[model samples]
Target: MTSTENEAHRRDGADPGHRHLFHVPPADGGRYPESAYLAGNSLGLQPRATRTELLADLDAWSRLGVEGHLEAERPWLPYHGLLTAPAARLVGARPSETVVMNSLTVNLHLLMVSFYRPAGERTRIVIEDTAFPSDSYAVRSQARFHGLDPDTTVVRLRPRDGEENLRTEDVTAFLAAEGHTVALVLLGGVNYLTGELLDIPAITAAGRAAGAVVGWDLAHAAGNVPLSLHDWDVDFAAWCSYKYLNSGPGALAGVFVHERHHGDTGLPRFEGWWSTAADTRFEMTPVSRPPATVEAWQISNPPIFAMGPVRTSLELFDAVGMPALRDRSLRLTGYLERLLDEVTADRPLTVVTPRDPARRGCQLSVRIGTGNANELTKRLRHEHGVIADAREPDIVRFAPVPLYSTYHDCWRVADALAATVEATS
Candidate 1:
């Protein structure tokens, strides 16, 4: 380990057991040791417990057949409930306000059905200028569904002419001026590309004061940082478990609807049998008696196999808890920043992610000012075994997840990046 890494370990008091909790894949077809796996912003490393938990679930399915729904180790019938308390704790929501089901965009559309009510002259939606493509598409489709043209109705808050990130004051100023005409304000809790953590509470309060429903797409924030969605009075939110949550690829996602919205018959939402009261769920009732909780948003039965990894990962998060995790995340990310300073020394690399811990998550988006970023990224991976993702044009993102990533991993990535720059230059 580098002296920097050893110093970090000594300073942070990192537990030796943390890395063992994850199954870090080997590099070079297992010929060499594992590379510095720093791409948790895209897909997290699998938890070691996931395999055992999944095997147990499969065994229950094999042994009990349909009886697994009620008799299995974790019970498939109320399976989604198994994740409720822990998932809620991750996002700082009440158990009654959260549900684990569906994929990320799917739940966004489902929540939008009830929350994005465009009416009269107030028929606009507000989002970030550089929102993740999927979120932009979903919002546009919702606007079109409501008979509004997306071009004029979809408002965006862009950074100032020379700024790399949006300022909180600017967001509130936009909301103060146009929040009245905005039917909904949807933003990423942590922006996907820039890694900026928007001021959700201030923005939520501003949007609500102007009488617009507000929601957050927490795809990049859920398990990477601490949240207080309940105290923040966020109207609703949704996030995928694959990123940071470490629940496998395309795993089931989570939804949060404030408890205040529960059981409101006037709320408009598409419902199926599973979205109703559990006792009457199997009654085959023609009328939808939606439950008095966020479960009412469910339209189908929980996927037992899909939730296997989610249960395993959430259990890990419950044991570690978000506060301790966030503390480690801050230090890890700060260490990455320090390493990047040394890597980019005498070079033209720039960090697009905010420097302040309060304004960003674990990911640091680095842009090369004078070279092909994608080519440099390829060299970093192929030559030095540093695995960071490159975005279009000129951005490479490295997410040193607190759960499994070590200070040694951060040092390795920086060392590789420095060498790659010199070779490419």
Candidate 2:
């Protein structure tokens, strides 16, 4: 009923004093204690719910002792099972195709033992040039275990000149052109240094077309982005729960194996009592038939107390769906980037993270030109209390996790970064 101009002028949810849902600006009009907690890519902030969950487990342990395996609210016997469905939902996998068990690297080595079977000329491994160091080491060791030389067998995918991010085409093209020789395509779901998210669906299809197995290291991407491991037809993937999932330091990690891989009762694995068939496990039989889902990868009984915090973190995701969480993340990171530009004003710094939202999660990898980044990170901590991470030579990585981080936190990072840069210069 109103004129177009009038209708356009009226904002739908305008309240001049509106604040972002998570915004709690520094109270002292100075840096708050939590401002320096931008290391969620390395480790997440502990949720307030973690303590209660831990106490519940402790109480169960004390009350039931040996019977706690079947007695508690979350029985120790099936506690890891309870995590599978939720973790599967988090990573875009079927409940029957995922499990939370071993740590990240351990899962990688074990998965390789089962999936990285190289034969004849198809014994080469494809990896990114800037792949995480631990992954490089593991892949190399895997090749050596199979009588292949890593220097000759490992194929590194590289970005074009003057580029810090990898192109999906280059990755796929490498797979296609060199398809005949490639055995496994192992790369991070999100490149850890640049925070560039690869096109998983496309990459997986390409790798499969090339007759290679595709696996992802989701250490940085797992809870930060929406994944569809089952839909994409990935062979396997591994991720630590300590980062975006906020499951405390070095917590139980998750693994996903395609449903097709489960029934192969004869595939190799580094097995132990926990991985033996549950019905016959206590019998201590020499036979080990992995559980139908990915839990068959477990080599030892889970550390119940360590899993408590992870259980609490996954509950937070259930409360706040990934869609809404990612919505807030995009806005918060953009706000930080804009404020950085305002303060820096054409400074030498350049952001390596993709400008596209689809290509990044909650991280902004700022390339501080030609100077010492480590010292800058240290100064930010001691002087300003703005905790961000410094990558080797010159980049400082900042990740503001949506669950606990806020617009004001992003604002503070920008403000502090500008001050730090100007002072350092």
TM-score of each: 0.96, 0.91
Q: Give the worst 10-residue stretch by lDDT in candidate 1.
A: 8-17
Which regions of candidate 2 fall more than 4 Å away from where they truly are?
1-33
lDDT of 2: 0.81
Flag clash pairs in model 1. none
Across residues 1-425, which tens digit of lDDT does each residue of candidate 1 receive? 13465675665464432788888877642123987899899999988889988999999989999999899988999988989999999999999999999999999999999999988888999999999999999999999998889999899889999889999999999888877799999999999988999988999999999899999999999998899999999999999999999999999999999999998988899988798899887888899888899999999998898998998899899999889888888888898898887777677788899999999999999988765778877777777777888887788899989888888778778877777677767
Cα RMSD of all models vs. native, in order, equals: 1.9, 5.1
The per-residue C-alpha lDDT of model 1 at residue 167 equals 97
21-128: candidate 2 lDDT, tens digit per residue: 222324322346445467788878777668877999999989999999998888998787778778888999998888888799999999999989899999999989
> For each predicted model, how many residue pairs clash, with residues at least 3 apart or on different chains?
0, 1
Residue pairs clashing, model 2:
36-387
All models: lDDT?
A: 0.89, 0.81
